[model samples]
Target chain A: MRIGVVTFPGSLDDVDAQRAVRVAGGDPVALWHGDHDLQGVDAVVLPGGFSYGDYLRCGAIARFAPVMSEVVDAAHHGLPVLGICNGFQILCESHLLPGALVRNDHQRFVCRDQRLRIEDATSAWTGSYAAGQEIVVPLKNGEGGYVADEATLDALEGEGHVVARYLGGNPNGSLRDIAGIRNAAGNVVGLMPHPEHAVEDLCGPGTDGLGFFTSALRALVG
Target chain B: MARVVVDVMLKPEILDPQGKAVHGALPRLGFGGISDVRQGKRFELEVEGEVTEERLAEVRQIAETLLSNPVIEDYAVRVEQ
Candidate 1:
């Protein structure tokens, strides 16, 4: 399968995302923010970074990039999309997801191996793992706090859309320890931690993150 | 030309870490009795033409769709001279 990784002006993890995709047995396609085309890739990954310098709000400015229009439209049609860290911010800004990422409650940039529980393994990007499985990946960000209205939060929990939850401790003060979530169709997902960084044992926290890519591959084949 | 100012702020239900930090520092600097502080953003736009009801409505739309996230923030728009 072919997975496209979009590169915004300040995107720092697109390369890692691409490498992870390759390692997971999918071809990686490089996509540009300003490009109107998605290059007809089977899936897309919005990698992490301080896109557009995180101006006007993290992912706020980058959400207006030409590429996002296509990404948003494609995502609505059940095209699998995974957003990591700043990419999570972009998804929220684009209204593809239901929450906003605010400054961390600790008021500092945090980096660590974050433990996360796979709450819903049925999502397209998480099928490689068993439900309730716990994994650790690199979590790094300053504005990673996840916030949503109370009703929305309740609905997310009620509907089984909360894809992952923080296991050890809340890294960025995310509400209810929500580490990731999926859309109603389970095709789109946005998460705060950097799973791409953990796909290789030589660099990051083991290879626990390879499940995301491999899961997407399974979704495409099935 | 008309200048439009837009103020965007997090919704009351949302936590503001930056604002909280500022509020924490306030007590250290001799300020007291401050209940809370919420942080926000302000944008100033200078329109090239006359400001009309239509233009103001457009500005409101821009503020709603872009300047502030409806999920966690609220925004207000006004004309400034």
Candidate 2:
């Protein structure tokens, strides 16, 4: 399967994202932020980074990139999109997902391996795992807190859109211990963690992050 | 002319590390009496001319659909006298 990884200005993890796709045995394509076209890829990833220097709020400016227009369109048409870290911020900023990321409650950037339980593994990007399976991925960000109103939180829980939850102590004080979520359509996924960085065993962690890419590949071919 | 104040905050379910850190620091800073501190963003807009309620409404919509994320934060608006 062919997966497209978008690179916006200040996107620090695009190359790592593309490499992760390759490691998952899918063809990786590099997409530009200024281009609105998808280049006919089966899936897309918005890699992590401090886009637009995190000015005016993280992911706020990058959400307006031309590539998001295509990402939004493709996500609606059932194409899978996975956004990591700052990419998750962009996803929320673009309204692809339903929330925002704010500064860490600790007021400092937290970087470490975070344990997350696969809450809903049926989404296109998570189908490889069983619900409640635990995996560890790198989490690094100053603005990684997840928030929403009580009613919307109820809706997310009621609909089972919550994809991943913190397994250990809450890393960033995310409400309900939420670490990730998928869109209502189940095609788009966003998480404020660095899964790409953990895709290789040589990277000082387990390769559990590779499942996300492989899951997307299988979903695309299926 | 008219104006508005916009306030945005992280949802209760989401952790507020900034707030938590500040709360944690109260004891170290010798402010043990303080119990909690939550950090948020405040925006004030100075609107001109038309001064219609619709204009204020439009600004709020922009804040939600564009300016802020409804999932992670909530926004509040108040009209100027």
| Candidate 2, DockQ score (0 to 1) | 0.51
- The TM-scores of all predictions, comma-separated, are 0.97, 0.83
lDDT of 2 by residue, A1-222 (tens): 889999989999999999999999999999999997989999999999999899768988898888888888888899999999988998888888886777776677898988999999999989999998999988898888787777878999999999999887988768888999999989999988777888888883789899899999888788
* Global lDDT of each candidate: 0.94, 0.86
Candidate 1 regions off by >4 Å? none
User: What does TM-score give for chain A of every model?
Assistant: 0.99, 0.98
How far out, in Å, is residue A129 in model 1? 0.2
Local accuracy of candidate 1 as per-residue lDDT tens digits, B1-81: 889999999888788888999999998999999999888999999997999999999999999988888888899998996
The lDDT leader among the candidates is 1
Q: Best by DockQ, which number? A: 1
